[model samples]
Target: MKNYTVVAKDSFTVLGIGTELRSDYTDYAGITKEKADFWESIKQDGRLETLKAVATNNYIFAVNEAVNNKMMHYAGVMTEASVPEASRLIQFPKGEYLVVKGEAQTAEELSNKLTGIAFGQVLSEVKDVAYVGGPNATVEMGQQNGILFGEMWIPVVRK
Candidate 1:
């Protein structure tokens, strides 16, 4: 069984470069590819590195949100600093959050695994809290013993 917890968090902001995903929300493969491509583009062009230079920590955040009724994804960092290349500043409110933690062989795998477990298993099985659909993120905290580890943070309201 997947392990998860509900935790309280203070407000935070992430500076990011984003793309509006064109794939249907239910098309997991398509959305994954789009997010992968977006990450590759940001890395290849040094946007990710630029963000990292000003980051408060080494953690990388992959954020998913809906804006103007369109599915949007972002590669971001927790930073108070702003860059001209950033497409948006994502705001996560102060509230309870559904936090799912896990590890994988790679950052990509970690993201997919955490996302799947959080959305497919944890959220569906858990009671008392419900995700209300704000900007949720898979935070790539770091690696240990050659394994990538992180947590998925989804804002939720107590039901």
Candidate 2:
């Protein structure tokens, strides 16, 4: 899967990747609060190890994660200076994306299906895809009961 460059919309997305502290995310509720800390700690202490674990395709993208309805507020530790009001959420880069399409029953169901299917199944069959969209950013398919469609987007190093 050779990477292609295309402009992407700027928006918010919940990035869920990297080795989960609690495998299976059985403790999903505890994940987010520790996410920033985990990222920062690695960024500071183990720069080289962090770089080796995986490659980063930093690009602007929009995806929806089902609001777990559980609020994990960080007291807005990020001040107004860091992020302007116009852009409430921040994405890594200006543009470019790798997209995947999927249809399923629920957002969660769809997400699960995509994770298991799009990446887990498809990539295994197509090894080059690893060189393209390195990792995906999950998006909650539009609101629907019992079923929905989700399109996963990843930042690929543009060809």
Candidate 3:
């Protein structure tokens, strides 16, 4: 069984710099490439570092959400403060969340692994809750033993 847990969480806001994901929803490879490219651009341009400077903690958040029928992705941090360069203040509603944890050699691998496990395996097996759709995130908390570790948090509703 995939290692996961459902937990209650308080509402929080993430300040982010975002881009609309243009790939078809069914195209996993396209979507993954778009996300990877976006992250690379942000990192190279110092956008990620700017967001990190205002972060409440060291955790870096890569969030996905559908906004007005458009697939949106963000590189963000948890903070009440805002930067003029930020694209949005994404809000995560207070609720139960399906949390999937994992670690990998790189942040990119860790995100892909956790996301695959969460959607491809765990969400399908869980009987008591369902993901109703909002902003979901892959939180890159830190590194340990040269490995990147994080958790994917998807808000869920109990069935």
Tell me the tens digit of each residue's lDDT in model 1 across 1-159. 549988999999999899999999999999999888888898899999999999999999999999999999988999989999999999999999999999999878899999999999999998899997999999999989999999999999999
Tens-digit per-residue lDDT, 37-150, candidate 2: 554554576542333233233221223222233322111111122322121232434355555666676434455555555555554454333424222454543545555655
Off by over 4 Å in 2: 1-21, 24-90, 125-135, 143-146
Q: All models: lDDT?
A: 0.93, 0.40, 0.93
Q: Using alpha carbons, what is the TM-score of model 3?
A: 0.97
Q: How far off is residue 17 in model 1, in Å?
A: 0.7
**Pairs in clash, predicted candidate 3:** none
* Candidate 2: Cα lDDT at 146: 50
Model 2: lDDT to the true structure: 0.40
Question: Model 1, which residues run further than 4 Å from truth?
Answer: none
Q: Residues 1-159, candidate 3, lDDT per residue (tens digit)?
A: 659999999999999999999999889999999999999999999989889999999989989999999999999999978887799999999989999999999878988899999999999999999998999999999998899999999999999
